[model samples]
Target: MLKPYQVYNTHSLSLCYNDYLLLQLLLCFWSSLFSLCLSLARNTKKILYLLQVAHKNSSMAKSICFCLQKLVFFILLSAIVSHARPPQVLPRQEPSYLKFVFNATDLPSEDYYDYIVVGGGTAGCPLAASLSHTFRVLLLERGGIAYGKANLMTQDGFLSTLVEVNAFDSPAQAFTSEDGVPNARGRVLGGSSAINAGFYSRADMDFYKNSGINWDLKLVNESYDWVERAIVFRPELKNWQSAVRDGLLEAGVDPYNGFSLDHIPGTKIGGSTFDSFGRRHSAADLLLYARAANIRVGVYASVERVLLASTTPFSGSRQSAIGVVFRDSNGRYHHAMVRRHGEVILSAGAIGSPQLLLLSGVGPRPQLSAWGIPVARHSPYVGQFLYDNPRNGISIVPSIPLEHSLIQVVGITEDGAYIEAASNIIPFASPARSVFIHTPSSPLYLTVATLMEKIVGPVSSGSLRLGSLDVRVNPIIRFNYFNNPVDVRRCVNGTRKLAGVLRSRSMEDFKFRDWFGNRDFRFVGPALPVNQTDEDQMADFCRRTVSTIWHYHGGCVVGKVVDGDFMVMGMNGLRVVDGSVFGVSPGTNPQATLMMMGRYVGMKIIRDRLRYS
Candidate 1:
């Protein structure tokens, strides 16, 4: 056991490390500024000396030299003060609950808890925290904590973190769907919330009405309020985001909704997890509310499978989950068992929860037989009905430079399309090297500003299957984009809405003049079809440019894999309480809803336990 003083020392060291990095950045900035100043001083001195030498007693020359020297000095002073301002220091205080978090390798071979919550992600963290209020809880995260990582903590590092891949420890895990579109999943403590664009919006009323879960409307609102109070913030709009908002309104997107967290049909500036100072507040931060004494967070603890034993009279047919076997970072395994009447919850998002169920022999019987794994329960829909909202849009290079921004303004069209905008500065390899070679040492970069639209409640769906026996390997996921005609029509309508926005008068300043003096938007990728009225052309564009907005859900869905209470059907002591239960992606972004589900379900579980006891 660590002494209290020793724990304090450790936390102090972590804070110091962050301060050290900040100091280094400041030093580098000052050094560059000093070098430039020295060079400018030398040039000014030479100029003044030459002027004096050319006109030995000319007062005009002296006056010119004086003015030049003053001008140069003023410019240098301004540059130093304006450009060399130190970066905003991140919040120094670590969460008090972090004291309960431990490296998985440091844990014993076996442990017992009232609840074992897998995946310390957007949903899992809050779920585990809420559970901790009334019961001993264990939260297991496959990846390390995001607390001190500057890249995951700040808005400026959003795109950079998403683009970082090809490493086992990279926060964003890259995967290409069978549809051949590139996508990413968060591998860090906060899951996708840590690596996402940080947009926050509540689910639409239709979501709750369609969600099958028996929700207490008052509690639902309260749960959303709980999450909002902790993490959500009102974003200050910049040039690009403001223009998108105006253009959306000009294109008939509605009566402006202004700033709101509610999901309403109109152009509105929604909440963000990125605060005014640009630091991100992910779902992992919700752990701060946990009862530290009751909650234990184990990082780098990858759950291999849920352990099951016969529940019937030695029949070995009917089984229930009693514990889980997880592998530590060092490849050593540990067991976490639930105590009497305790449960094991899978809050591992849409992909992970289903994948885990299959791995634990709870999937289709034939699939388990092929893998030589014993079938604990036959769940046909464990990995079925996978859906990813296909994001189709156009990226354009603005005529005037725009400040970097993520999704702030959203246009909810009555035609079942949601439009959003982001301006990102993406790094690229120099021309001499392959574009695939993305290294921090590479100096080249490109500013990609985009207007994207995603359809609401896409009817198209597919499935997820094991790609490899290894849990670390990404599964074979095929979302079957635009598989349904309804989805295609929605996409076409959304694309048409985007075209309308581009044609709006508000976008005129962003358009560039061509060689023939015809002003047009300079497209970074494929431009919108010339004939927006052509449904066939618009449909083709939607199919061709279909990409993931990372709003994928389903698999282990309610009423099929799990019941309305979120417990796995035909199984006891096992429940899935994540985005997997979402029949349709909620609102504009699912992060807010996913986070709310964690708190909501956890509170429900506590209430049920109290009533039964």
Candidate 2:
């Protein structure tokens, strides 16, 4: 955790650059106004004599005062214009839909809901919204309300939100794995969607096939349309995004697959959650689809564990889940139950969902006993087989100012690796330097070009273990990235491919210049050392320098911890939805796929509830 001063210092550089420009310019007028006031004093005697003579005649006095006031107003206006600061776009204001939202402290009298959806995030928000149409639903989130922090989310501050020191107060909760990989998860109602780059793309066809579940492709397409209408947009490709697309084609990614959501081979442009005006539309926005009367959302409500009945409804199965125990903002605990034939759904993300199950005594018997948690069922795979789409990349500091753009083009390798590039377009001007130099020229924009790769589903595996029985304590996470030899080779090839693309003749127009005036440009991550040709060395470099692209799945996989319908293997009336149920990584940013899973699960539960009733 960073201290207050450290936090301030970390943000001060960018904050001052973005916010203090006007303040510095206004300060210059202080001295100028003092001299102007002295000059006005010399004319005071003459003005008073004119005023006294005019007072003898009322109309002349009124005319003279009006003229003097107008002249003074124009003079101030001119002075302000002359010292005006350079143009900078202001961050967007928060959305106005917060009036209908509620905090956990003010829950309704009804303790029973037709469906209890834990975690009001990317998956949970849409699932609750979808289920609300048919049954009364309860949605709970552990984070504070995100309604009033629009500027922090919608603007370029998305990156800052991830590194926020106050973990509980921030929308993003940062954590480091046992292997020392730094990662973060969204803690707000929108979940990770509130803090991500907003790139929207569906999973590849292989992802669905490998899941071993029968999905109606037509219904899946309909669900995609349902989400698209609310938040997805075709991003207008800027200069940087355009150059990346051309470069990928030049590197033989082949056949430009223009403007589509489907994960096709070759280079293609995808959708984004951010609109044309640069305002972010999070998954929480999809709550608009919910039936307001039947839906109740409670933010800052942390779920402790799933409550189970003393006996199972079935003759020989795990105990039936009845409700949940949660803590509110005031540190008050509450038990929220479900109506008869209703269900409890856990959409608390990859980490939270699995941890909840383990806390509820539904994990491996040996591990639960080791943690002193009473065992209700002996499901061995509650938090096993975790996968993080590890990404190895290169970043170049270009000499030319790059236009702002998120990921637009993606290259799908035959070996099942995904590659893409992105850059920040927000312009900046150094206020401190401008004040000292007395010049208002354009500041150098830090343009970053990255070539990132994600292995769709790798042979390597990791696990999440309980640090303690306490719900407040986070679980131990380890990605064990690149443990498989196959994964190592795929990353090596992908990294080389990205380097080739950058050196391609198509990228010749833009000079890849470093921020420092050196002929040698900067290469981010593990650079291919000069004349280093050993595959073993390249593999080692990747292992030490790899980072997650934030697409983590499994841990509570469908076939392992849950069934084909996403129901807990041993427990009745309990299901896990969210990325934790993903049998494999989606091969791209998993936001689109996660939302689709929420929609699918919501619809499935609705159908099952109606059939049973």
Candidate 3:
């Protein structure tokens, strides 16, 4: 009934009216919501203020009663947020050689491999990658990848990972020796190298000579270069570290070797596995050298046993290793067969390698029979000759604070001791502290300067025996540290020598003093008793306090268990390239040496079997 212009105007007015109504409704809703929020916030502030005032003014019981409701609310809120949120989904760049197996279903259907390397650790990762250059290698790791572990990346997180009970099932498996020495090993891909203090130094040349194996020293040097280029970096010495270096130099550890990876007998700054930005570069990075198509890395694949075939080409009488049986993350067991002319190498570290060997019925015949396990080989020395590098240290709280540092300045002693110093920047909470109280207005901090002294080439030795048949359980280790008179003397001497370093002008500048449970007091080990003949007290301290730096070696000695080429003497197609095959401990942090051993053995296999067999 209306004209065209009137009709258009009417429609436009209706649309505008509807839009205006909607806008007004939204504004009203927002205004009410904002006011409610403001009221709630003010109430919250008042409640917090009341709680604080009551806590300060009232008795302890009254304060707790008043704050219980607020605490309960916050706890509930935190629980809701945590459980309501989805799990963190990590981004992936499709790996060529690496396959993260969450369960048995994730593994490939094929069961054959050219080489099976057990334990994707420092030695195993590089060894598998190197062998895969010419063979279809399978690297099985029991633990997950370390790329996104927040606990491993932070500064004080190392301590948290070490001390926290919740972290027992973490990649770093913590254990205590029968002697009550607390130690840990990496269940992760990088092994102990990933969890260690990160120092990277080649063994002293004497280590090679003492090893009794005909090591191609030239090739050893090349392997060192190969590893160092990938992971080693010269650490920047901080205030406390530099002061310790000066103290070492002043204490007659002469011939200052500046920023070198060579294991020299003097004050020197060594390389760390962490890069300049403090990011750790583990041996897992060495897998980059492999041709992706030739390698298959399965994380959380726990190798249970090495499969042996009756026919042996190398040794007519003995059985040959042709495959391995492992359990995936889902607890499903799978078998992997070795190809023709292929081998099974055990790079599962000192304790793990021997344990696996024993589990596979390749250890001492008597022990195997006692355990009711079928003996595959009568290798008597499979778990013998186990030794650990023992460390004794003194902790001091200086009048002035100390900077955080790892192993930096070391004083190699004539009496077979490697003395080093470390400090933590955070407040040194004593073990007795029931609670660490921190306030926003005045933050409390403490610094602990620890002088650690390790005995080089310790005479004390022990054994690693199978605790059970389960691969999940850790082996029982009995490291008889300070058992030998010579070892006790060296540890005592080492502590005394480090005490002298603390007495130097550089260390005295900070007024270094001992830390009681709660208070800091002046008590130096050397100055204790403040008189002559404190040797007895010092010796007692060494005996009671000596623990392992976790540099465990031997069990599968090169000459006794495996031959010079790292092959098992009585078996074929089975070799060990881990710290277990060491003829002797390299008398330093054994990470670099263990890596070199892996490389050397891989190269040997390439030359002896892959190329010329």
By TM-score, who's the top model here? 1
lDDT of each: 0.82, 0.74, 0.72
For residues 1-613, could you state the per-residue lDDT of candidate 2 as single tens digits?
1111001111121332222432343343334554556666888997788888997988888777666554553344333233333223344444433434567767743399989999988899889989988999889888865554643445455554655536455687878888788888888888988888888998788888888567878877877788889999998887667887888888877678899898888888899998876667888888888887788788888889999875544546458889999887788888899988788999999999999999999999999999888898999998999988887776654445555556777887777767787764322335355432344553423344555666767778898989877666678999888889889988877776676677676566555322232234444334664543668777776787788778887899988999888889877889998999877777778899888878877887777777977
Best by lDDT: 1
By TM-score, the better pick of 1 and 2 is 1
Instruction: Flag clash pairs in model 2.
Output: 404-425
Q: Name the lDDT of candidate 1.
A: 0.82
Scored by Cα lDDT, where does model 3 land?
0.72
TM-scores for all candidates: the values are: 0.84, 0.82, 0.79
Model 3 CA deviation exceeding 4 Å by range? 1-105, 165-168, 312-317, 427-445, 512-532, 610-613
Clashes per candidate (backbone, < 3 Å): 0, 1, 0
Lowest-sum lDDT 10-residue window in model 1: 9-18
lDDT of 3 at 204: 83
By TM-score, how accurate is candidate 2? 0.82
